[model samples]
Target chain A: MNLRRTTTATALLAAALASVAAPGWSDTLRLQGYYDYVDLQLGLQLPTVVVPGEPTPFGLFAENAGPGTADYPVLLLSGGNNMQIEGVSGCTSLELPQRTCALAPLVANWAHVLRFRFHLEPFSRGIVVFGAALTSEAVDTNPGNELQVVSIPIVAEAETRVAFVDVVPETLVDGRLAWTVRVDNDGPSAAISPFVYNASWAYGGLVDVQCTSNGTASCPDQMNYLGPGSGWNIRLVAPPLSVDNPEIQVGYGVQPQEASNAFDNDGVWLVYRDAFFRDGFE
Target chain B: MAAVEGLMRGPRGLASFARAFGAACGGPLPALAAMLILQCHATTAPWSFVVMVVLALPAWWRDDGARLSLVDASALAIALAFAVSGLGPGWRFDGANAVPVAGFVALVLLARHARQGDAARVVALLAVVALLQLVPALVAYTRTGDPSLALRDAAVPWLVVPNDLAWMACAWPWWIALARERAGATRIAIVALLALQLVAFVLFGSRIAIAAAAVGTGYALLRDARGRWIGAGALGLAAAATFALGKGVASLEARMELWRAAWSLFVANPVFGLGAHGFVAGYREWMPAIPVDPRVTPWPHSLPLELLAQWGVVGFVAVALALVASWRSARGRRGRYALAPVAIAFALVACVEASAMRLWVWMFAALLLAWPRLDEGQEGTEAP
Candidate 1:
């Protein structure tokens, strides 16, 4: 028994040495998953003006209330609202000739939030986040009343949060290969309805979308659209999934806008808000 | 006369003093010169610095105690020609990256001395220097497992063909020479080490290196034959086998791809091809868009193709003339020295695998020209 024990120890030592000598063999490996959150802001400003026969440079118009006297109402235009004539006052009835007058305000302010979501794969290295903010300028404002111009600063930020998970491989009795991947979104925000798709050799072959989100009956269907807010336990099958041979890609975004297809093999994508324009509505 | 006298007298007068001074400082001059030129142009200076440092020890060791040989003189002339031609109209000095040319000059001078038996000390010094590179390389490999592979990926990021090929071509000759010099237990040990390196090369999966080794070894083995009929018959059989199985070889397939690309470049600019460093920029104009790593530029990759793209047929002819001249001048065991040009020529042809063709070709040409004349009576003293 002692001899056998010695032999086993020697064999283990030799294996360790062999692994060290050979290239690309390692022990005590760690696979990490991460989630990145990004915040972005967009805004705009316009110049103020008044109307004469048209709108004036400062939105200040002169009107005779009574016999050569005039009055102007102080108007504050703010936040995405269009300019309009308020009212005329402060004139005697006999001093000035009767005149029809109006006051038009310039400049408007508007703000909206655009959210983009993405998931980090296990064991991936050096992932990067890229995005842009888009906006449009308004043309043809109210005559005599110019818009106040405000410089809109575009804001962008990215933060990476990492977590580790256990991967268990399984062989199905029906000659299929499958694996249950436990992906934890270590970030403050839950990964939300995350589903693994477009699996490749890098990610250990084809992975079919399996049941997720608390194992409910609707989990598989709903998990296809992920990122509501929770870690995902997904099971995937292979072979048939290898036809398109698509690369492994995970995507997420805010309400209304769904994540687009993975940009490329590197799993990169860009997101931004659509442009806004003013019609005739007040 | 005064200047010459001063040179002979001032701290430089003593042979030992001059030798020590040169040892201490002369080795870095080429790199320093390169750095200055690079700095003047406002290009990246670090690459030039690294390349210069890499070339310095080899250059110094080669030139230390040696005299200029015919081969060295000819190489120097060629390098000078390139440098001069580079200064011509349409060639912007700022971007030409003249350090490689400068390094070529240093190597030529070193080769001349090596031919004269004056470079023994330099060779010894260089052996130490080359050995030092093994430290970091080995450490990196130990940490990451494959240093060269990692470096190649980090540096180039996209194509793997040329980097692997150039490394194999550069090291194979040295390995063969080292193997030839060893005996018994030591020989076995050396061979084992060489095998490990070769295995590493294979792991790089470079088709170019594998093919170059096969062709180079075949040429070496076929240099001499007992009878014309037997030799002819053997050649015919070999040719048939090669034709039948060449495509099965991955290296050959890669070479064919490179050749096709090169041929296209030649056809497009049959005249004075693209400008220096122009091939990478021009690849998009000629080739279809392939998903390429953002880090790697589209370089022609083959030496001949690079020449054809950059210098046109004229530059190619100049290179050919230089190679032929060196080949004709080499004497003694012509077969062995012949390997120098053949290796270089094959490497040039295989440029799609590496960017060292110009450097290797010039180095081989210098060695060829500086090869000690058999009549010089120093033949017996030549170190392996």
Candidate 2:
């Protein structure tokens, strides 16, 4: 009995030592399953600009939040077959052995989540459904969590044109100054993220905005999108500027890599609103 | 003078210092040549730094002593040439190059301090490191059916290959030293360890490295005359099999085109060649039969051809001389064996990898095969 115990222990030790000796072996032994199955969850990342007829980048991210390793029984991306996976090289004789073709295979864990980005094809403007799912052969604990769909409503536009619509003077800085500058986006398509406008004053300048606000009420510096003809009143607060010119340079052209006409994109204006310093009063 | 003194001080005065320093510390050369064979990358690699500080630096700081014959003057010259070229048009230099050069220098410094018992210690230390690396490799394998199959994890390009190969090389001297000492169980363990590393490396699909390892392994077994014949025959068989199996066809065709391109570059400036690191520029102008719509690569993939093309015969001779010098230094039983991995890796690197661009590749021949150390009851027979 003693010898048997000793022998067993020795073999175990040898096996353990052997396992430990290999580079990546020890990490495997800690896993609970014989082999894990992936439980995949998918989501979408909207691009900077989603025009109705123009090409734009849109990404779909899949996460496997499971202890199990996942191999694709099926990976489906709905945009029909014309949507080419952007960076994928040509398929070899079974680069992935599991399926005839898969978006990606062996999506083991969250670390190796499968992602696909495509030039979102031009379809009729409406809520465009970009849906993706990964059905793993591995035992998924939450089977319902497999499929994900992101339906982004693509707003229909007239002939594509966006420009600085209107900049209205709201308030004047009294003591430690405060005022509201209304910036509007007139567009066939919405102005995304960076709404860059130039504010130049003649005598005393307005610089250093306190904060930006929209929808609710707060000081506005940045904006999400300028829905066609709808504008956000961005209030500006400043300490003081050396170039104290009271004139505010209204709206500049849309700052894109390439634009059709720069002249139509930008418009200039002078502040008609009275400031305490311009009035030379309290 | 101070630089020379620093390299030598780790051993003794110039001559003995040269001998002791040049002799193999083993691991770094092959590792640099091949890259990491899937292992605990962070852990296995960091041990070198620890070994440097603990083992090498103290001895060097005290002006310790030893003996030698190897040098990489040609490598140095080529690197200098490349550095000059890298500085061309603009200072377009490879930043990560210093890593390999540093790895090379570290091997030299460590070998200078090596003793008889140090082999066992290094082997043991490296076994741990290799095992740690293997842990990641295995986990990776388990998750993804193929072992070598992983996303492109290049914090640095081809960084992992040489480091792993060096660590893998570390096991060799230990294997030899252990065998020489007749340390039975330990030898088995080391063998098992190496097998594991090789399996992981293969699954990683670094086909070039796999070939290099095979070459290195053949050299390892070729200690005696009988073993030599066996090794040679096996290598020939491997070559024959590679062709017979049709595996070599694609590689051969690719290499032929690369060699042609390289040839074109060489013919253009036969003497001085295209002023070191000028292969790509030359390729664009010369544009030999491009296979797979071949774009300009830094290396033509074949080491000898690349050398011939870029540095001309002069640069090529410098490398050949360096190898010869290293061989001369690490001659005899273990020295020969130790140099095997270095030689094979270089040969493999020549055929496949851009090892010349990575100065550390040269360091293998420079550092692993020979080094200077005190005659501390250790025979200078063993190789890195």
Winner by TM-score = 2
lDDT of 2 at B244: 48
* TM-score of each prediction: 0.41, 0.45
Instruction: Please write out the lDDT profile of model 2 over residues B37-73, one tens digit for every residue.
Output: 2223433432333333332323343332323224434
True lDDT of residue A145, candidate 1: 18
DockQ of 2: 0.01
Error of 1 at B232 (Å): 16
Give me the TM-scores for chain A across all models, comma-separated. 0.24, 0.34
Error of 1 at A30 (Å): 32
lDDT assessment of candidate 2: 0.45
Cand. 2 TM to true fold? 0.45
iRMSD for every model? 24.4, 20.1
